[model samples]
Structures are given as structure tokens and as C-alpha cells.
Target: MGRLPLGVTTLALFFGTQATTGSLETASTVSAAAMIGMAAGAPLQGQLLDRFAKPVVIVCFTVLQVATFVALAVAVNGGSATWTLAVLALCQGMTIPSLPSCTRLVLKRAVSAGEVDAAFALDTTLMEVIYVSGPAIAAGVTATWGPQGLFLGCAVLVAAGTIFFVRVTGARWLGPDPGQAERAPDKEDLRPRPHDSRHWLPAGGFVLAMALLAAPFGLIECALTQFGTEQGTGLSLTGLILSVTGLGSIAGGLAYGTVRWRTGPARRFVVLVLGQGAAITVVAVLPSLGVVWTGLTLAALCTVPLASICFHMLDLLSPPGIWMRMQSWGAVANTGGHAAGVTLGGYIATAYGSGATFALVGLCAFLAIMAAMPALLNPSVRRPEPAKVGAHAE
Candidate 1:
């Protein structure tokens, strides 16, 4: 329920603002501000989730999120200034709950070591489902009740979902008291630890790899949209082409989870990155849209599996108590890479066309593969012994 409303709220922000202000530029500015806010706020919010009680942090953020959505809806309807709308949008993004990271943290505690890979993969697949279906639901809501109704509906859904999630997961998985965890010894402390120099190389390398892995996705999305426009194919066909990639990711994630691979996540990570890059490069040179669709779908088979691998590796590597924070930082890296890819892709698409933009997407993937190599090469960076179930609960 919480995840589903995100697409509706996002669409309401853009289309509702455009409807009221009659300026695409204003809508774009508001949307960009929200993205910036999310990128900036994720780490901080993660810290809060790590440091405080789960229920308190979640409830507080939900209230703020609901208020921001309602305020933005009112402002848009009132024809408020662009700056005011932007501020509200930014607040909304900042307050948007980091439920995915929270879920990962819970899974780290609730699932057995033997089941970790499959659990994470299932989580990744669910996320893919949300991304694919959320927009379609948003479209339906907007068509029936308009953007204002959609915004109101989003607010209701968020509130209801948060209450339900906290009620269901709070006592069972989140632990009885975060204070007990907080009062544990220094070795068991839940606070963010000071950085140790020895771990920097692997940690920094992992962050860089994640960023690089994400950039090609943004580039390809922009390139595909431009390709569709250039072909004069309508939005419906273009959306279908893009949806194929999501479907591929869902399939890949589910299939990956069903297997028990002998190799470590680090090795699998590098292989998947290289394979995806090679696939994209091969397809980018092709002239036919049909081929592009097929190639992208094949390439995207690596997407969610890569995410599952990354998160699993994170679980292996992160110091006890900082899992959520590390996950948030991972999100920040992805957001940054995606923003850069979209910016570069836009300029390239405008100047050189969609084909060139697609080529750049391939280049970004190869660059990511290079960034990931250090993790594969560094023998000293082995996974730590698994924590006992419920060892790091909040």
C-alpha cells in the first residue's frame, strides 16, 4: 500500500502542477527538486532509523509525508508560486519513508543465512513489481478522479499503509525496545562507527560500483524515450517497450532466487555487470526498434539480480547496527549516478540523436564494470561470518 501510492503521488505532482501553472518547466523544476531532496535526505533518514525506535521514526516521517502531500495538493490547486510548490515537494521527498531499506534490515534479522540470497532476490522482485504496476495504477486514478483526487488518495493510502505496516511488523520483527539495543556494549553498539582506514578501499569500491551500475539505466531510459519520439511512435508503444525491461527484471530476479549458486556475490556481481554491458553495447549499434526492444529486455535480465547481489554483499560487509545507513548510502549513490546519466543522455540525445544516446548507455555500463573490478580482485575482502537471527534488530 505504501509503495503503490508513490507513483500516483509522483504523477500528481507533475501533471497537477502542469495543469494549474500551465508550464512544463515549472513542473520539471518541482520534480527535480524532489529528487534532489531524496538524494540528500536518504542518508540522514537512514541514520535516524538506525539510531531511534522504528515505530517512532516511521510514524513521525509518515505524518510529515502526509502533511507535505496535502499541502502540495492545496498549493497546486491554489496556483501557489513555483518556489512554494518546490519547497513542499522537497519536504515530501525528504519525508518519504525508506521502507525498502527497512525491509532489508528486517530480512537480515528474520531470514536464516542459507535463505539470505533468495530472500533478497524476492525483495528485489517485489520492488520490480511495484515499479511496473505503480504507474499504471496512477494513470487509472488520474483518469477517474483527476490529479487532485489522486493526491488525496495517495495521502490516504500512505497513512493507512504505514499504520498497517507498523502494526504488523513492529512487534514481531522490529523488536520490543530499541533502547536495549542502544545500551549494548561498544562492540555491539548500533551507532554508526567511525570509519576504519583498512575497510575504505572495499567500501569505496562497492559504492562506486553501485553508482556505475545505475547510470546506464538512466541513460537507456532517456535514449528509449527519445528513440520513440524520433520514430513518431505514440506514447503507448513506447511505454510497452519500456515495460518489457521491467518484466525481464522481474523474471530474472525470480529465477536467480530459485537457484543456489556456489560462487560468492562479489564474483557474480562482476560477471553480471560485464555481461549486461556487453549486451547493451551489442544492441546499441543495431538499427531496428524491434531489435532494440529485444536487446534491452535481454540486457535488463541482469538488473534486479545485480541489485540482489549488491544488497546481499552489503549485508555481508556492513558493520553491525549500520545496515540501514549503508543501504541508504547505496541509494544515494544510485540516485547520483542516475541523475548524471539522465543529464548526459539528454544533451547527447539532443545533439547526436537516440542512437548515440544508446551507445553512451553502453559506455556507462562498461565504465561500471571497470569500477566493479576492484571488488572482484581484492582477496582480502571476504564476507564476514553471518550474524545470528535477530542479532541486529531495531
Candidate 2:
């Protein structure tokens, strides 16, 4: 439910900005504004996750997000000026916390170490499906009614989704209604040490992993869009490429579950990560457009699989009750890396060309591999302990 609103808003934001602004520079900046908004809110959202009932937080933020998007639509279509857009953009950013955090929270409870990989694969695949479907829906709306309609429609859907999610998730408010005393503890305290040093390691490692992983793919996305345009493929064709990638992600997720890989996740992760880079390299070096497209397809195939493995690793590794926070942190890391990638890619593409930029993407993947070597090599990274269960007031 959370996914629907976010997906719709993102698509509308990206496509709508492109239509209204007509300048890649402006559109990219708008996109960055939205992303930065989300990034800025991550830590606060994480704190909320630790403190509030997941469903309540989800519903509240979801409503805020949809409403903000509506305001944004009004600002953009009504010509309310740049300040209105900035305010709406920042408000929409606060809504970014609920969806991914909820998914990771569920995984923490329902999935065990053995199933973490499959869970991540499934999660990544679902995210891809959302990306594919949402943008197409936005495009259809945009095609019929112009870009502003896209935002209006997205806001409506998001609002509806939030309502539905709250009703469905069966989340109750955590604290005493208004003024009741908190529940008494019946068991020993299971909370972390107030000054625990160990807690930082998992968080730091997860963040680093996501940052590294995001770099290549982020740059590749920019380069691929350029590549598509260069190949005389229209915007519709670019959409098709992304949709095909989503289809591949679904297949990859199903296969990950079916295969139920027995070996440690690290090897599979490294292999798929490199494979993704290799596929991008093929696109960079290959002469024919067909080969390049095929390479892009293959590159898409590599994405969800590696992400799935990493998510699973994180599930196994993070402390109990910290799932939402950790997930948010990973997301923030990815967003940060993507921002960096865009900046770096733009610079490199301007200096050398699109093809060389793709090559640099491959180099980023290599660097990520190197960055993760310590955890990837150590078997101790996969600790198999259950998170101690107790009432966390928050």
C-alpha cells in the first residue's frame, strides 16, 4: 500500500518535471531535490520507527506525502513560484520513510537467516515491479492530460493507498491512548547497551555496502538514458527498457527462491555484482545497438539478485528491533551514492563521452567490491542468532 503512493509520486515527479521544464538540467535538479528531501528525513524516520508503531507511522507519513504531492501539483500547475515548489518538495520528502521501512520490519520478524536471501530478492523484485508499473501509469496519464495531471492522479492514489494500508496492516497505536501509563516489563531488559560500540558496525557496514552498490547502477542509469536517445530510441522505448528490466527482476527473484542457494551469500553477491559491471562494460564497448541493448538487459538481470543477497546479509546481521532504521540507513546510503554518481557521471560524460562514463560505472562496481572485501571474506559476518524479543515501548 505504501509502495503505490511512493511509486506514483516518483514517476510523476520525474516525468512531470521533464515535461514541464523540458530541460534535462532542471529536471535532474528537481529530481535531486526530491531525493535529497528523502535523504534528509531518513534518520528522523528511523528514530520514528524505533519509537512508534509501524502502521501508525506509515499511515501518518503516507497521508502527509500524498497531501504534499497534491500541494506540489497545485504549485506547479497554478504557477505558485519556486518557493512553493521547494516547500512542497520538502514536505513530500518526509513521506519517504514508511514504505521501505515497513518491508524491512516485516522481514525482520518473518524471515530467518536461512531465508534472508530469498526475502531480499523478493523485496528487490517487488520494488522493480513497482518502478515499472508506476511510471507507465504516470506516462499514460501524462500522455492524455499533460504532466500536471500525473501529479494530481498520483496524489489521489497515494492518499487512497495510505488509507487502505492503515486498515489492512492492523496496526494499533503503541502508547497509552492519550494519557495511560506504559505497560510494565515482565521479562529482563533486552535493550542494547546505552553505549554499545557493536551496534555501529552493522549499521556502518550496511551503509558502506549500499553506497558502493549504488554507484555503478546509478551512473549506468544516466548513461543508459543517453544511450537510448543516441540509438534513436524514443522515450517510449526507454520506458520499455525499464519495464523489461523489471520483468527480469521478477524472474531473478523467483529463481533465487527456487534455487535456495546453500553456499554463503558473499560469493553469489560478488559474482552478480561483477556480472552487472561486465554487462555494462559490454554495452560500453560493443558497437551494435542490438548488442548494447542486450547488454543492458543482462545488466538489469544482475541488479536485483545482488541487492537481494545484500538485503539478506543485512537481515542476518542487524540487531533486533532495528530493522526499520537499518533499512532506512541503507536507503539513505543508496540515495547519497546515486547523487554522487549523477554528479560524477555528468562530469565524465561531458569530458569523455557516454561510453567512457559507463566504463567508469564498471570501475565503481570494482571499487565497491574492494570496499566490502573485509565483510565478504569473513564467515563471522553471518552470525545466526535470533534478535532478543521484548516489549520496546517505541
Most TM-score-accurate candidate: 1
lDDT (Cα) of model 1: 0.75
For each predicted model, how many residue pairs clash, with residues at least 3 apart or on different chains? Answer: 0, 1
Give a tens-digit lDDT track for model 2, residues 9-50: 655666766677665665556666778888888878876866
Badly placed stretches (over 4 Å) of model 1 are 175-194, 229-237, 377-394
Instruction: Write down the lDDT of every candidate, Cα atoms only.
Output: 0.75, 0.66
TM match of model 1 to true structure: 0.88
For each candidate in turn, the TM-score is 0.88, 0.81
Candidate 1 lDDT, tens digit per residue, 288-327?
7777877888888998999998877655555545666778
In model 2, pairs of residues that clash are 51-394
